[model samples]
Target: MRGVVYFIIVMLVASSLGCISEKIEKPDKKRIHGPKTKKIEEKRQVDSTRKRLGVVSGKWEQLNGMDGGDMHFIYSTRSGVLFVSHGFGGVWRSKNGGESWEIIKQEDFTDVYFYDMEEIGEVLYAGSNKGLWYSLDEGESWTKLKTGFPEIDDGTYHLVSLAKYKDELFFTAVLDKKYRNGRPGDGRLFVLKRDKTILELEAPANKEITVSAKYPYLFISSPYSGLFFSTDGKRWRKILDKKTTNVFVDGKYNLYVGTIGDWWYIGRKIGNTWKWEQVKIPGRKNTNSIFYFLVPDPINENRLWFGCGGVSRFYSFSARGFGNSFFGVGCWNGELKDWKIHSNYATSIAFYGDEKVKTSCGEATKYALVTVGRQAVQKTMDGGLNWSNSYEGVFGDTINAINPIKSGILSGTIVVTAVSGTEIAFNNGEEWMKGIDLRLGKEVGGGKLPGYPWCAVSPERRIEGKYDLLISTGYPSPFRGDGVFGIDTSCLVRGGRNCVKKLIGGPHYEMVISEGKLYAGNMDNGIDVLDLETMEVSKIDFGSGVPLIRKFDGKLFFETYEGKYLGDGWRWSGKKGKIYFYDGRVTKTIYEEYAINFSVNNREFIALTPESLVYKPDFLSEEEIRVKLPNKKYTDMAIAWEKGIIFLSTDGEGVFYTTIDELKSGGVRLKEFNNGLLTLKIRNLVYEDGYLFAGTRGYSVWRVKPSQV
Candidate 1:
């Protein structure tokens, strides 16, 4: 009896092994029988460079505890490596899903951005604001593709699309007419054949372009220029008149187009013509919604997953959007009646796995990962019903403001507020974590003034090993009425429910703490003085609205701005460009007129005007001393008073520094001081603890000892 059972088990095992081998030899021949389906399988075989592994799943945690600002593209390989290109933050890679990430490469050219990426086997290609780049060996290193095109490295080509049609790879770039050598043109499209030769083709316009392949036919969607298609690579024909954002083709050869501000919204190709399919999104109208990207389900061809956002013109004064949020992700199962949407802005989507999983609501998807703009990467398992932020090991963030404590138990701790909210670094920015919990409740405004921590200031005193901070918020809607909140460091460790508390509500832009008073600047209101002893708030009208206020040389100096109000329903006239000096009792105007930014050293005070840099010996002096700078727009300035040097951060020309005495003498030559910086487009600068910290646009934050410069 035992021998008979063993024989039966052996026979069953052999039968299963034979079936597996047979299935591999003769794969499923299921085909999407639609128009122009000839040679579709051959094309699929040619496009075998990308192989997907199992779904990426886990709790949403900071990928390497950093924010990679505005992710433009995301790709994954069968070897389990993930890649993401932050438009300004540079390119990042991860081996273990998103548990951690390391920057593999950044644009050598200043202000250029990597906008799109494509994976072909072990090689990867990227399109950028300037030109094309390629990486071999799984993105550990990269090199620019400068062959064939002579001017590819000129920074004029805004390469927007890198796609594959049939077996040929192609890229499209928008060239600015101002840099096109008097040529009346929009953009260029280049194709890389199997033999590596390049062919130039005419593109519709230089605007946002998306290219997709549907067997033998190729489709191109250009915003504002409509949609075009071609059977051959050289010639194209316009088919649609509406502005389109993206193009997608499913397994059944069905064509779908994402439109921008179109009445027909989403376009679907049916039979031989295009049909408008309106998938009603909740709380959104056709005019305000934008279907950004579309991808077909691998197992369920009828189901389509899409990424969407709102049009730029859609502004909400209500509590929900407060201002505007063009962000959403969802799926449509060929049903116009219902769809699922998760509110977030997604740039690209990739799928993995073949296991069918359904949500409690009966919605299903295999496995998917999406790269959301600014919010970084996210993943979903049970379709679009649920999603998690998979941004571990990613660090493409724009540091808006940075504040460091000088002494006490939290002495070495630094707090940085950025596009991804607030982060606290206990070890001087070596590692960071989510800092404060802004109890933004639920819904649009979250019942509180929904905004981000703009700038934070702490009292010179600490209690119970806890530091208290008066953190100011930014982008406050007029409907909410305030942007100031307070937090204690104790709540940061305990994860308390009310980690942040509202102090004073109103439009405050900048804040400074001195003595027992907190001076806050605003756009609509003048300056707000909040007394810590009495907790009473009072206003100090500085004629126009004060946008900048700082404590320099033991006195307060602020700049007033003349600009129109841009909040929901708020209105303000304007004020002249003026800088004022404020003591605890009195205020006086020092230097007025078109000042961009100002700083002070131990010798004198310097202010950057639209035309030149001006210096004055006394705070109340009328004598004008000027230092003519190069034709570069200075965005921010910082002064290391102890070092007697002033640093100016420009929009594109990196950073320049000079001695304060040289500027006063009117013969100062600004010297470049960007030795260890990643990006030259520094947005903000801070000097603290003998280190000059630069908050850049796409490269997170950098700090260097001032003495080294």
Candidate 2:
């Protein structure tokens, strides 16, 4: 009867093994697919090289637009140059007649705008949101000219126009106190003589003014207070006060005033008597109005240029055609011929809308994959599709490994075995707080640690939570020693005010927590597991392999370079390539080779290799293997057993993932997202909630959600 029962159990076990093996089938060979590729090899090289330097390269191409800002043009007469300032301090200068442009400078200043420029003899004057800037050597160098300005509102003053009349210069300064919420004072116009002295002029109370200097007289226009003429720095006379906004003067002293309302007047010098006459142009009458105009021709006096609304016109003071229109800037030899618009102007008009085009994702939400060459970390949020350069500022260009604290937050530790710097970010990949020198004591190596740092983060150590950081460092090899530091999440809530306690230190590689026990892997000192409650440490010898601890099914599992130990006395030996289970007195070995790592999911043992996952039910005899992963180059893997997910990072290819069931089914069912990488060369993977975080050698850190892919 006992033998009969044993035979029934054996039959059931055989049947179960057959069923599991039938379910696990080898996946069909298929071409691996990643992110969209264009210049794959070139991008890979650029991404890798930049990661080594610890400085992000290339312009933030994604921040072209999508904000409420306008682009204004700046021209240099001395250099015949034209540039564009994105009103916000980003300046791009074009040298080749608007053919191409290069960024000159991008300063971070709020509510700043560049207004006008004027070259007087050898000095170049620029009017902007701040005030006036004077360059002595023809725009080569500039100095702030804010001597005689009002100190109460100097930086806030907006200079609208700068006009040079002979040796003297006159400028219109608008004090936008309204924008400042009725702070104090009104707008004024200050005339600066060639001697750098202010020539005070009597102006209206609080009107926005525009000015133009024409030798013996200066023309000023207000949006609502009409036109005024000033001479000798003090006296002013009303010329055509009718809500005018812009004004221009020719070499012959003929004044042209444009009104915000529907009016463009031409004041001619007839026998010393300035007679104002209204000239009619061809454009629709009473619908469009002139904004401003400029006469670039130095020779022709009667040749008038009119800039109305969004169009430009040229009139000879004689031809009677509907508003004579001509674009571009050049001279005519007084042939009384119809003027033609320049081709460049036509092209500009054709692509005018392109100027406002911006990336749909603003500066905050975009993701970038970054990598450092060595001793640093890299990250890419777009799945190795497009990558940014390495982020330095943290480890002073010496980052060893990265651990994700939480979503959009990462921590990097240096290699030299000392706490040097840390970086934190909250707004996706837009900006980061760099150079957070925690100043956590001296170097590990007596030979000067290259910003020696190695960092680990708890599950809640992101922007949403506080504290939760661990770091350790020590000299490499023969001089190795134990030094570990830990930071509690609650203490970080108040901005790192709490002290960091020392744990154990050595050439630490990885730190993990399993079953409420903290474990630190060291190269020279084996593995140290600390009891969070008792504060006691236990050293585990991994023999020739490094000791690693991981949690599965609420139980801790130990791994070494050779094989794995599943708590109790069960040990899987890779020497004979077999599995064994012992009840302390006897040991058994079963034939099963090429298994790399194992985890327990739902009380079942799951094994992993470079390209597959194996599931063993109860004993090795009843086992099933599935080939899910591709043969692509990979560097590391992290499994979240409870979530049934596996994160695989590649060398220069970025990070990817798959499910446990998909892997056991032997059919590679993986979804690769756009992470912007050719080779991520990741070093580690961490999972918290449903987000997967990747750590790379030189790359900072990266994170993404399962559903986001």
Whose lDDT is greatest here?
A: 1
Q: How well is each residue in 1-709 modelled by candidate 1, as lDDT tens digits?
A: 0000000000111100000010011211231111221221101111224332112111111123335456767777666677777666466778766656677644363455566677666677777766777878777876777746756667665676777766677777666444646443355677878887777877655454667776677777776578877778667778777767667676655666766555224456676556666544566665545556665566654456676555221111012232123333344554432356666556577665555776432445656778765557777766655677666556667665555543223434555666555556544354543433232321323465455446656665542234376566555443453566666666765766555566677656667766667778865668888786677989998666776776554456777877664441111122356877665566667766757667643325677665566776654555666766667766666666665667777756777776665665554566677764556777666665555666666666676655531
The lowest-lDDT stretch of 10 consecutive residues in candidate 1 is 1-10
lDDT of 2 by residue, 194-284 (tens): 6787766777534677778877787777755677776664677777757565566766787766655354667776764468766434342
TM-score of 1: 0.78
Q: Candidate 2 local accuracy as lDDT?
A: 0.42
In candidate 2, where is summed lDDT lowest over 10 consecutive residues? 1-10
lDDT of each: 0.57, 0.42
All candidates: TM-score: 0.78, 0.37
